[model samples]
Target: MTEFTLIPASGAAVPAEPFTGRHLIDGLWKDSADGATFDRVSPSHGVLVSRSAKGGEAEVLAAIAAARRAFDAGDWSFSSGKSRSEILNRVADLIDRDRERIARIEVLESGKPIAQARGEIEGAADIWRYAAALARMAHGDSHNNLGPDMLGLVLKEPIGVAAIITPWNFPFLIVSQKLPFALAAGCTAVVKPSEMTPSTTVILFELLEEAGLPAGVANLVLGYGDPVGAVMTTHPDVDMVSFTGSTGVGKRIVAAASGTLKKVSLELGGKNPQVIFPDADLDAAADAIAFGIYFNAGECCNSGSRIIVHEDVAEALTDRIAVLSRKVPFGDPLSDATQVGAIISDEHLGKIDGYVREAQAAGAKVVIGGGVLAVPGLDGRFYAPTVVAGVTPDMAIAREEVFGPVLSVLTFKTEDEAIELANNAAYGLSAGVWSLDVHTCLNFARKVRAGTVWTNTWMDGFAELPFGGVKESGLGRELGRFGIEEYLELKTVQMRVARGRNNWVAG
Candidate 1:
């Protein structure tokens, strides 16, 4: 590995390393069939980081074929739990070995705060380790007690070649959430990281090979979603598809996968809510709300972009929110003090701006910062942390996933009204409740229609818990033992100890 330094969007530098930016197929690092490549640049700065192989249908097919071959060879997916555990553990070790460099690369690509980026790297390593332990413990069930003359068995088998497509924000963390479990379940995979930030996984390919993952056990293809993503979902050779992105794209993948009737798992969009009751600690609630919407520049599927406050405390909470929102330091992604960073791309920046502009045009008040920020030394996409007051539940800014540093505040006179507003959206990925009263918090958490509910907290996760959504948010879960099961197919086996007479009609 050659030493390199990445420049943040604000032109701050941090030591890093360069990735080959090549596709890993069948244990080989190769360019695209057409020899095409796309530049991978920092979201913090518009500077070129490297050029990654631009893949499409051909690359997708190759990756799927490689994954299928490996799964069929039984060197991986059909191997014993112990054998799988050894390789999975090795991968974990490699991740920790290169954690610092990986974190730097993530900041270079995603333009998230260095502190959060480092935390994600550590969390990803923990996930791999957790999966490694699970790999050794993946067991089937048996019931010899069925009868003296009979036995029953329930087996969990690998679902074969899995196609994993991840998004740009929290690229490595999200991929780790899916891939490690697939590996633990003894499945081979064809992975397509978002074109914007595929370098981390490209580096993982190198590490997986070093960890002795067999050829085709895990393949990496970097490219745009159009043809590559479509190929993965529609390809006959793929046994399953796991995707993390927008709800619209998730639906598209589902429609395409229906052609083959392949197993599909999606972690989609979220217009998540943070509901604060009058009995809550207003200051603490404001702090959590700030972190909720501004973490990763609010480019998270579970971002709490919708703020529903009790009418009694709405004005007070709004004041604290503005104060805390301004405290979110912004500048170099590599800077330790930076809490929020640049937007992922110009396209996404424009989308965020449009939402704010439209909301303002509709009579919403800009309580504080509400537009793009121009950093003196950076050419990256940066947006100010914005809070919109007088927001209605039906407003576009209040209803949609802003995926930026923007929060829309709404007021509710009753608990029923709060729950109604929170659950009104088409998304149900996650939500948060901040209240000192146990009953109030519990009631809101139970009534809110979301996959994950945090009481007196926001956005904390663990490897032992399942993460996903309901309704338009997603299909299927990831994380924990259940996550690994997403890559497994269950089969029931029955046997008779003694065979009696058989009927001739059976023939």
Candidate 2:
């Protein structure tokens, strides 16, 4: 038995009554037609956090119809760029004003550290501000050099309505990444956040209403994926679908949308890697590796779950990370001192531990903590930060996404071997290299198949750059200029200034 130090629960006040959430169809908030609702128990505190109207086929249809009607009405779709930009900026200001309220709900429902949740809210606000900037700057092309008698014009228009489905791991942040951009493109939308964490999104809708968004321009449904998300994906009225979740679900969305042939954009799972070379700054690399795996309790889609290190320094680096892993606080999410919080659920905690146990059974060695963590005075489920050494490229722990604070270490003797090992996974979301040699860094960055590659850093992101994945990781990109384009359609207009076209009909 391994006895671990746990941070005690903080004195932060829990609400006397759970939050009540409902479906936002058109511009009105209403309960489910059948009056069925679901409750969310805080994963960290074991207290009732929220009770939401469980949406079914009827709610889904109603929301979709609202978005379709709004788009067709052209009230928002045909609005000037300046108008859309102003609304988005106002929404951003509201997000900042309600930052504490949203962050607290996120911390309670998602079981993430309070500080981290606050940071995510801040990041979401920044994304909204960036999307506001994009609204006014969006433009099409024009050509006057076709000929003296002819002119050409290209125009970008909104893609009717979009269905946005987000996951539980990053409820507010992920929706912020998608919805504001869709709105900025002059598109109406129906959004569905995960049932486990729907209150933050509910708060966002309140902000949207306060911002004076046109009625039915954006609607929200609260529930599971089957009736809510399935209808959204296959609905003929929807012009596009943007989802962030697992790869299996991503594939299902693609298949469901095939019948209607609606555009589908996904940001899916990852088994991201961080490769270390002998010439790297070992101390800096060690600190980053520790942060990468432990951050978010390794539940991030871009989590660096595995490391491929050169043979000469593999042992030393692994030891360093193991020591740091033990030092990361794992306890109550309400505590500002806790770095790693409770697992989202007992089932997910089991899944994480199962992966590490299987790897150890197959010849991998546990370098540090390897089992459940008991936080003082709390009943929430937690897993200790684990590092598994002697992992081979063929091991399941090395190839699959454990989505936990578990790190797998594998050694490579040559650069080609490192690249081969890094590319062996079914995912290509992100990869990182930590070498001081500029040539070495450049070579790896060029050769890696990931959507985002870091030379000496891990998980540095900005609103100006596009983010997504390749292969099974996902399809299309989000953020940057490309984000809004996903919700837009292009049209070309050809004109004849000479007042007549060529006599193609022989008239």
The number of the candidate with the highest TM-score is 2
Q: What does candidate 2's lDDT look like per residue over 1-507, in tens digits?
A: 344557888877888899999989999999999999999999889999999999999999999999999999998999988999999999999999999999999989999999899999999999999999999999889999998998899999998899999999989999999999999999999999999999999999999999999889999999999899999999999999999999999999999999999999999999999999999988899999988998989999999999999999999999889778867888989888888888899899999999998999999999988898877778787889999999998899999999999999999999998999999989999999999889999999999899999888898889999999999999999999999998899999998888766787775
**Candidate 1 lDDT, tens digit per residue, 1-507?**
101122334446643534559899998989999999888777776666767899978888998999998889887877888888888788888988998888888888888888898899889989988888888888889999987878899998999989999999988999999998999998999999998898888878888999998888999988988888889889899999999999999999999999999999999999999988888988888888988988988898988898999888888999998887766787678788788888999999999999999999999999988877876578778888889999987799988888998999999998898899999999999999988889998898789889999999898899999999998999999998888889989999998877773577877
Q: For every candidate structure, what is the RMSD over all alpha carbons to the true structure, in angstroms?
A: 4.1, 1.1
Candidate 1 wrongly placed segments (more than 4 Å) = 1-11, 14-19, 499-507
Question: Candidate 1's C-alpha lDDT?
Answer: 0.87
Estimate candidate 2's alpha-carbon lDDT, on a 0 to 1 scale.
Answer: 0.93
Q: For residue 122, what is the lDDT in candidate 1?
A: 84
Instruction: Output the lDDT of residue 131, model 2.
Output: 97
Q: List the global CA lDDT of all models.
A: 0.87, 0.93
